[model samples]
Target: MTSFITPCDSLADVRSAIDQIDAMLVDLLAERGRYVREAARFKRNQAEVAAPDRVKQVIDKALAHALESGAEPEVVEAVYRSMVAAFIQIESRQHQALQARQAPDAGTMSGCICA
Candidate 1:
């Protein structure tokens, strides 16, 4: 039902390969967010909301990995910076919803600063 193909052997082939890879990355990202949502239920306090420092640390590590892997540092940084920002927003929202459900009377539980 499926077959394996090697990397692009020409410019057009390379473009096509890149497109396919991008699609796979999109799917993986969706799966990653699903897990993020599950983790959302555990963030009881608002302090655990956004955590810019943690995001920065993650971005730094991602950039380092990108460089070490011979990927374009600027491109990697840009992509991850945006990606992390978006995820943080999603995480914060999900955390808030969870906390509200778990503690309806409590006003904003405490944790890390949101981004």
Candidate 2:
């Protein structure tokens, strides 16, 4: 549950509200990053990290969500594109690390490479 400010007038009050919203966005992004890491575990190779079809689907969904929420679709699409690209890179690194850990010589290393 979240509490939203109504009719903010002062600069300080507006900044406070923005700060709260930014905190929530950070929490959401962290949750999304966790899911991205989990997704990396399921992927067989790095190619699956930059999945074009899923990217298109996500962008389309973001556009629809922005339109439905009275936000600018273009802005939402741009944000999603940038966010997805970053996540793809993270996933790619995670995939490579997992692959390396799975290699035969990985037995010499410690516990949980994904950690």
RMSD of each: 9.5, 6.9
Residues 1-115, candidate 1: write the lDDT tens digits: 2346686679999889889899999999999899877877777665675777877898899888887777789999999888888887888889988766677455555774888
Computed on alpha carbons, the lDDT of every model, listed in order, comes to 0.81, 0.89
- Position 66, candidate 2: lDDT: 82
Model 2 earns a TM-score of 0.85
Error of 2 at 57 (Å): 0.5
lDDT score, candidate 1: 0.81
Query: Number of clashing residue pairs in every model?
Result: 6, 0
Model 2, position 18: C-alpha lDDT score: 89
Give the per-residue Cα lDDT of candidate 2 at 23.
Answer: 100
- 1-112, model 2: which lDDT tens digit per residue? 2334588889999899889889999999999999999899999987788899999999999898888777789899889999999999998999899998888785456565
